[model samples]
Target: MQYQAVVRKFGPAAEAVEIERAALPVLRRDQVRVRLLARSINPSDIITISGAYAGRTTLPFIPGFEAFGVVEACGEDVYGLAPGTRVLPVRGAGGWQEYKHTDPSWCLRVPDGLSDFEAATSYVNPMTAWLMLHKKIGLRPGMRIAVNAAASSIGSILIGLANAVGVEPVAIVRSEESRARLSGSLEAVIVDRADSDLATGLAGRHGLDAVLDCVGGAHASILAAALKPGGHFVHYGLLSGQSIPPSFWSSHPDIAFSFFHLREWVHSEAMENVQRAYAEVAAQIAAKIIATEVREVFPLEKIRLALQSTLPFRTGGKVLLA
Candidate 1:
């Protein structure tokens, strides 16, 4: 049978992506074939297409971060899932195609009443937000948490989750434009590009519990300075250059720093716990607590356009390839 794929070509903006006919992937005894319904374009997918993520991908490989699809065929040993079940794969690559072959252990069943779009955007961002708040930070009611990039997909969910746990989230955005885009859902504090002024604004701050930092250049150090004594900082993404000042650690002896990769954490957790986390995300979707904004939807024919448009500062919501 024929399937659709987004093919990538690296050149001077000459057909960077193209929709091509491909054969359906075969399902192994430990795998299942998924008929994709929707897939979201994340920043990671952008880097992959730009040739910056070549280390993690082979040439001409399918590129996608997260997607929701229906199971077309299940392997003999796949018991928890069956044909027609809506599911999402665990990892961040190769969900952009029309059909995908994935290990049964990596698939999470989508709960009833959740739309394909919601499920498509569920696995990466929301799960990261939930894990950072509940597991790594151990934020409790009345505690204060700080999140950089608070207007992005993960940042949006962070605000919602913090509010649910009664933790006050101080949202940090890079520009005045970003600061203006946030809703009045949480207590937001905007950060300017000038470190001198930004540091002055946050000086003498105490009782700051945790910092969820995505930018890792000079910005991480600024965030480190804002933390209270004995506070924790979770470094997940390096949107900025991946280096930080040495003085950050030396100056703050009471503060701690650690990195978190959701893929590593998911693989370590039990299967039952992963299933429970999927259910929780579905519930949050149904309740409108966690919402994904789809900036645009591209059909198979427009895969090239879809891939090119997912760059930073160009789109506001998640870009989906359907």
Candidate 2:
């Protein structure tokens, strides 16, 4: 009984998503058939399903970005990959499906050291955190950086990865509760969401060399001003359902501004470079330098409940579909 969580129309994610029974995809000459063991529900997936990227997104598609599975079958030309070999269909089109067919090139062999849950979430946030720091910003030891929505899985990963390399990362969170969740964990700044004085907060602590922001709109606006001259400001997510003012680019002429979309990097980068990143991230995960915490796991049939638990950054961990 093959199953997939499909979105036929754009709307709110929890309501628009539907589980449909379908036949397994036929293996192509250069492909392998993998039975997906686990998938993760990310904010990016939620918005994409709701038509956030409607311009590029094709409807009537399965909505999932990360998952891990085991090779169950191979195409006529496929070789070496044996049945029961655990693997991650890295960046597959429809990870929500029970069976995913892909060219062997897209699959990364999952190490036995990683559990199914960990492997299922090995990409996306981890990759985003890695590339943004290492590739995009060229983060070096002792460089000062700040990450907002600092309690998210990605934020936590950024903190750990930065610390591992001797970079100092400041956490900027909203509200006292969010700050409390991270109290004493690191240097944190709590600001009012409506109208934060993040710049002022940074002044006392010393301005940042770079700022990595996921919360857009007002929070991003505030963080933008806090960057040192010639500093980089990278915006990746817009959880606030708003955009930073276009005028900010002109207002901060001395600051470098950019946005990061993992898909763009993966699609354009050479496979060897991308695989090198995979190896590094996997090694860190294996060593417990960074981790993706699972708040709960729901079977494919329970997607609605699982989605409802997509708690705002910080407190609740990632919701997984297993």
Candidate with the greatest TM-score versus the true structure: 2
Spell out the clash pairs found in candidate 2.
Answer: none
What are the Cα lDDT values of the candidates? 0.77, 0.81
Q: Write down the TM-score for model 1.
A: 0.90
Cα lDDT tens digits, model 2, 152-192, are: 77878888888888775788777777666552235556564
lDDT (Cα, 0-100) at 11 in candidate 1: 35
Model 2 segments more than 4 A misplaced: 183-185, 311-314
TM-score of each: 0.90, 0.93
Once fitted onto the true fold, the runs of candidate 1 whose alpha carbons sit more than 4 angstroms away are 1-16, 50-56, 313-315
Model 1, 1-322: lDDT tens per residue? 5445554564322255556777665678878888888987776666667777667667677777688899999888888788998888765577867888888778888987888888889888888888888788887897877888887778888888787767668888777777776764665576656767557656666568899988787767777877888889999887875777787778778887888877778878997798898788778878888887888898856776776676553317877877
RMSD to native for every prediction? 2.4, 1.9
